[model samples]
Target: MRIAIDAMGGDFGPRVVIPACIDALTRHPHLSLTLVGQQDEISAYIPSAERQQFADRLTVLHADKVIGNTDKPSHALRQRKQTSMHEALCLVADGHAQACVSAGNTGALMALSRFVLKMLPGIDRPAIITAIPSRKGDSYMLDLGANVDCSAEHLLQFAIMGSVMTQAVAGIAEPKVGLLNVGEEEIKGNEQVKLASRLIKEHGGINYAGFIEGDDICAGKVDVVVCDGFVGNIALKSSEGVARLIGRQLRDGFSGSVFRRLLGWLVKPVLQDIASYIDPARRNGASLLGLQGIVVKSHGGADRQCFGYAIDQAVAEVSMDVPNCINRQLEKSIAIKYRLKRSP
Candidate 1:
């Protein structure tokens, strides 16, 4: 499999992205990587020994321009044709690479991806979906800052796409799909959530699990959670904040006294495992679902390891043929629904 990397997209530029690409190449030997960015900057960071080791599997595509973090998506789309992010995505659109990964501006990335790759036949818009650690394992949530305002139909579309993605990428058969709402009762949510629930339940393809509250997300009540981008993004950021707070408090309490410090030492292994599990970097990849081709988005501030995780995500999706799976599932569901509607 071959994947394109936006080497100059993230806050740290090639410093983080280049190492991440190297790490991904080392881990996935069958993979080929094409780093898209300024050739000189990318080459300066990659040591000659490392380059020689993976010479056959690695290639650099020079792109002199870069899309800035704060650049407006509209302006970037029109003016940033020569940017690393745009070119990297172009590689996927042209089928030169199987997938593309970028830690660039979310809005700009989405705009460019949709314009270049186009949405699937039945999909009106592409939703952003990512995995988050949960008690049952990991839960996939969609519309995370992609489409802030969504309709009932959009939410239903998100449910279908999220369910298919979880099943394809995570190896979950019949993944339980949940609508993110304020309450578990069918009558509790607003018009959009309530209607989305009805639509999902009516659709036989998904394993609809009714409504799930915010707390249920961490408890792992469902494998897939669907919501508008506004709510999903807020929930994601808030959960991240709480995780940081708890981690900090635990560290401070553990160092408060000799006895506590000793206790901390005793539980050091357990704590380390928990820390790694909740680490955002480990879950750095978010898919731009509903697109015709596969595109993975990494956190703009992600480190080398985090960015590498994003690359891994792109590889997994490419290997699993996630976009094609979603297309097939969606077409099947629509066919079933059409038949049902025509029946007495």
Candidate 2:
């Protein structure tokens, strides 16, 4: 499968994106890339000799324009159809490529994806599903800043999508789903959470595991966490901040004393492994679910390693055929719901 890269989207633009493509190609020999950006800018990033060696696999599509970070999502697409990111999404929508990856403006990416690729059947809104690392493994979080305010039905749909994703990507046979809430009881949380809980419980197809509070996130109590975009985004950022603080404390504690320093040296490798697993940049990208095509969103500030991981994620998503699985499950759900509604 050919993956399209928005070579001009991120802060570093082609400087980071071009090398990421090379890195991905090095790791996965079967993978091919269609780099979208200004020809001159993209070519400058590739070495003459190396480009010749990978000439058969790499192709560049020139997109002279660019969408800035501050560009309004509503107007940017119409204003800049030739922009690198816009053109990359267009490639996926038009079947020029299997998937598109970008580290540009998150809002614009979602808006453009919805406008271009459109939503899948039975899907009201497209959600951003991010894989958050946990002690057991990686857990999926949904609606991460995609739909700020979601109805109970929307949350239910996110649960369905998240469960399907975790199963396909994380290799779980029947992934457990959790609703992010303030307390673990069935009656806890605000009106939205309560209503969502009712809907989730009534929708028996999903593997609903009841309410999951903030502390349960890292504990890996559930495989997928569903919440409105606002709450999900807040929880994601807060967790990132706490991880950084803990890393800093560990660093200071290790360096402050001779005895501590000796012990730290012995355990430094293990601590570093844990820190690397939880680092935001290592897990910064998200998959845009419910679209007609696959689109992965990376952090705007993502460095080379982060971009590389995002490419790996795109590969895995395509290999698993996540969009097709989601579509089939949604069709089954709608059919079941319709039949239940018509019954006496």
Candidate 3:
């Protein structure tokens, strides 16, 4: 399958994206890539031998413009069609590419995706969903800065979409779904969270796991966590901060004394394993769920390896036909609810 890359979008531009693409190509021989950006700049990072090696699998789509980090989503939508990000997404919309991955402006990515791909039939809004590292395993969380303000119905939609994503991408069967609330009790939380819980419990085709508090997120109480974009975004950022803090404290403690340093030396391999497990680079991709097409977003500041992780997600989702799975599951859910409503 062909995957489009916004080569000009990230903090380091093609310097990071090109190497990531090469790494992905090395790992996935079946993958074809279309690097979108100024041809000269992108080609500078790719040596002739490397180009020759992947000639059949790599292509470059020249885009004269780029959407900047500070550009408003609305302005980007109205005036940035010739940009690398926009053209990359267009390739997916036109079916020339199976998926598109970008480390560009998050708001701009979400806006362009909605405009280019449209929403799924039963989905009213698109959500940003990503896998968060958990004790038992990784749990998928949705609405991560996509739609800040959401309704009860929107949260329900996010639950179903997130559930399908976890099942399709994570390969979980009947993935347990939960609402991100302040408390585990059904009576807790505001009107929206409570109503969303009620809807999910009453609906079919979903494994509703009831309310999960913020502390339960990483504990792996559920496979999928649903919340408004405002809450999800904050939770994601806070977790990132805590991860960094823990990493720093561990480093400081390990290097503080000769004895501790000796101990660290003996456990270097184990520490590396633990660090890799918690590193944000290892889990860089966030899915733009509820879109008709597949789009993956990488952190704007992601490095080459981190960006590769994003590409890996896009590749897996494309191979799994995540969008089709979500659409089918949603159709079944709507039918089930309709039948329930019609029943005596």
Candidate 4:
């Protein structure tokens, strides 16, 4: 499958993204990538030998402009054309590529994706969903800064989409779905949460695990967690902060004292295992669910390996035909009939 990369979107631009594209090509020989960005800069990062070798597999699509971090989403949509980010998504929409990967401004990507690719049948708005590493496993969460204000019906849609995603990507037969709430009790949340709970529970096909507290998210009890963009974004940021804090504290504790340093050397292998388990790089890509085509967002600060994981995510979703899976499941469950036009 061919995946388009917005090589100019991330923090390091082509310096990081171009190398990651080469790495992905090396890993998946069948995979072809088209890097969209300033022609000269993108080409400069690629060595002559590897370029000649993968010439047929790797193509560069020159995009003169780039969407900057400070640009507003609305302005980016209205003004930025033929930009790396916009052109990348257009490749997916135009069927030139199966999926698109970008480490650009999240809001701009969302707006451009919605406008260019449109939304699938029965999906009102596109939701950003990503795997959050947990003790049990990775629990998928949705609406990560996509639609801050959502209705009960939106939450229900997020639930179905998240469930279908986990099943398809994670290969779980019947992934347990949960509604994020202040408390697990039925009486704890706002009106929308209560209504959403009833709707998801009433959907029948989804494995609704009822309301889940914030702590339950990482406890590994539930497979998919559903919430509004406001809540999901906050949870994502907070978790990231906590992950950094844990890593810092662990390093300081292990290396601060002479005795601890000796002990740390003894348990270095164990710490490596723990670090591998909790590494944020392992969970770098966040899928933009509900779009007509697959769009994977990489963190702007992500390195080559982390960005490659985002590309891998897009490849996996393309192989599984995620949009259709979600649509099929939505039709099967027919949760809260949405009066919207279907985009192909």
Model 2 lDDT-worst window of ten: 74-83
Q: What lDDT is reached at residue 78 by model 3?
A: 89
Candidate 4 ranges beyond 4 A from true positions? 335-344
Checking candidate 3 for backbone clashes, the offending pairs are none
Candidates 1 and 2 compared: the better one by lDDT is: 1
Error of 1 at 279 (Å): 1.7
Return model 2's CA RMSD, one decimal: 1.3
Better of 1 and 2 by TM-score: 1
lDDT string, candidate 2, 315-334, tens digits: 99999999999998898888
Backbone-clash count (model 1): 0
Q: In terms of lDDT, which candidate is strongest?
A: 3
- Model 1: how far is 324 from its true place, Å? 0.2
Task: Mark the 10 consecutive residues where model 3 has the least summed lDDT.
Answer: 273-282
TM-scores for candidates 1 onward, in order? 0.98, 0.97, 0.98, 0.96
lDDT string, candidate 4, 147-221, tens digits: 999999999999999999999999999999999999999988899999999989877789999999889889998
Q: Scored by CA lDDT, what does every candidate get? A: 0.92, 0.90, 0.92, 0.92
Clashes of each: 0, 0, 0, 0
Model 4 reaches what TM-score against the true structure?
0.96
Residue-by-residue lDDT tens digits, candidate 3, 1-344: 99999999979999999999999999999999999999999999998988999999999999999999999999999887689999999999999999999999999999999999999999999999999999997999998999989999999899999998898888888999989999988788999888888888888778998998999999989999999999999999999888888888888889978999999899889988888787767899999999989999999999988999999999999999999998998889889988998999
User: Per-prediction RMSD in angstroms?
Assistant: 0.9, 1.3, 0.9, 3.5
